[model samples]
Target: MRCDQVRQTLEESGEAYPAPVLHHLRHCPECAAYEHHWRWVRAGLLALARETAPEPSLGFARRLIRRLEEGFLPMRLVGEFFETAGRRVVYFTLLLATVLLLAIALPSSGPLRGRPARDVSWPQPEIVATRDYPIPPSELPGAGFSLTSESDVSGGQK
Candidate 1:
């Protein structure tokens, strides 16, 4: 390990003998020296006291309220309101509108919702079977023949 890494480990762990890294350091003279020096230097780094922080001002609350009243919230914090409000309204409105539009536009094909249609059955036309009048070759027009009125057949002869 480098000198700085050993120093950091010594400072963070605050131990004379590091079981994990000491094995690697003992084999390496540079690292072992770094660990030895860091252990001594760690004394200075560990000298910090809980009393070092300055006392809070008596008027801290009053000052904080004044700052709040002045609309001095951080830019990122100020943006949170607009961001959350826009997301709620836009997403909610879009979903609501989509649901309403779909309800109005879609076909309700269920038996209860759909209207009943008139019964209709389109059947294939059949060849007229009659023993009295035999179908002649001349009477055949096409694949599906349309029969003329009986009066028309007789009127043409008259």
Candidate 2:
């Protein structure tokens, strides 16, 4: 058998070589060296897997559990609600509904409110005219029309 066939057999069987592959290994020095190297690698990996992993100290799990249980309940609820897609969508929908209700319920108080806002008269009326008096001199400069009261200007002295 070829070296490749022997190598394939060695990898497939893990530490056990078939009798025919072993006969091939006895004749081929290169295949024998390769098999020995792969066997050492497998043994090292097996030993590493069997080694003990590190563990936390005695009360770590208890302390962590107690801390979680005693922490803020509202914050924990919010955290859990945001942890998944469906929960987050529900939370967002609830939040949107709350905002929408508040918007509808609260009375709006600004110039943009429901009732049409009355336009504020600019430059107050008194500045333009008095009850029945002539317009201000500063306002009407040269319209030559003069208002004469029947008591004063019917027949002028000057």
Candidate 3:
């Protein structure tokens, strides 16, 4: 077996060396050194496990829980609001007020206000009634010639 496989077996088995691992450890000096180092580390960890851990001062947990339950005061909550979102809201309001003030203060002739109106007058179209033109003699039906007015064509009383 490889040195890595032997070391892995030693780490996995923990104090119980398999037959193949024992054979490898006897042959590989580096693996034997690694196994020795791990043994010392395991002994130290075991010693630490046997000793009692340090305890917190009495009422520490109760005080912490009470503080969490009590929550923040209204003024402190307001202060926190100002520290975060309130400041941004104030800045945005100030910016909007400044833009509105500039729009009101500046003259209409300003570049951002757009182009001024020009004095342009288009020619008026001439309106000609159909009755204004005399009918051609050749276009009239045989033996009868009539000129109709706007009222006659529109079914109005003649």
Candidate 4:
């Protein structure tokens, strides 16, 4: 069997796999050799002491902690949120415009309460009725109509 096939079986629990996999490993020379080396390396790592430590350069931990603390302030977080949200606000404004257009295009069955509603003129008199000011066909001396008194024209009628 190939090392890939054997490595997969080694990674999974034996109870989750078929028994023939283990039997094949025992008979396959290459798989048996790979499994033997893998077990030896795993044992070496497990046998190490728990207290083993790696040495650190001077001020490395303190400088890393300082960098993390300086970069994660609340103001920086709020600024980043606005930067990410600005595009969404533009899209929301576009959606609101579309909604307004549709609202105007569709008619409603209520009082015209919306702004810029249609303006209707009041029911004014169409046919003016004035009597006794007789109309004349010709400006004759003795006529069907005549002015009783001469009135000045400037601001005169009122």
Best by lDDT: 3
- lDDT for residue 53 in candidate 3, whole number 0-100: 81
Q: Number of the top candidate by TM-score? A: 3
Error of 2 at 36 (Å): 1.2
- What number of backbone clashes does candidate 3 have, counting pairs of residues 3 or more apart or in separate chains? 0
* Model 3: residues with Cα > 4 Å off, grouped in runs: 72-158
- State in Å the error of residue 56, model 4: 10
Candidate 4: worst-modelled 10 consecutive residues by lDDT = 126-135
lDDT of each: 0.69, 0.76, 0.78, 0.65
TM-score of each: 0.33, 0.35, 0.42, 0.29
For candidate 1, the per-residue lDDT at 98 reads 100
Which parts of model 1 are misplaced by more than 4 Å? 1-12, 16-27, 49-51, 72-158
Model 2 scores worst on lDDT over the 10 consecutive residues at: 149-158
Q: Give the TM-score of candidate 3.
A: 0.42
What digit string (tens of lDDT, one per residue) describes model 4 on residues 1-158? Answer: 45587677775543344566687777888777877787777667667755568889899899878978888556778898898899899999999999999789776733455544344544433322232343233433456555533443222444
Off by over 4 Å in 4: 1-3, 12-18, 49-51, 54-158
lDDT of 3 by residue, 10-45 (tens): 988988899999998888899999999999998999
lDDT of 3: 0.78
C-alpha root-mean-square deviation, each candidate? 15.8, 21.3, 16.8, 20.9
What is the overall TM-score of model 4 with all chains considered together? Answer: 0.29
lDDT of 2 by residue, 3-76 (tens): 78889999889777799998999999999999999999989999999999999989988987887888835676
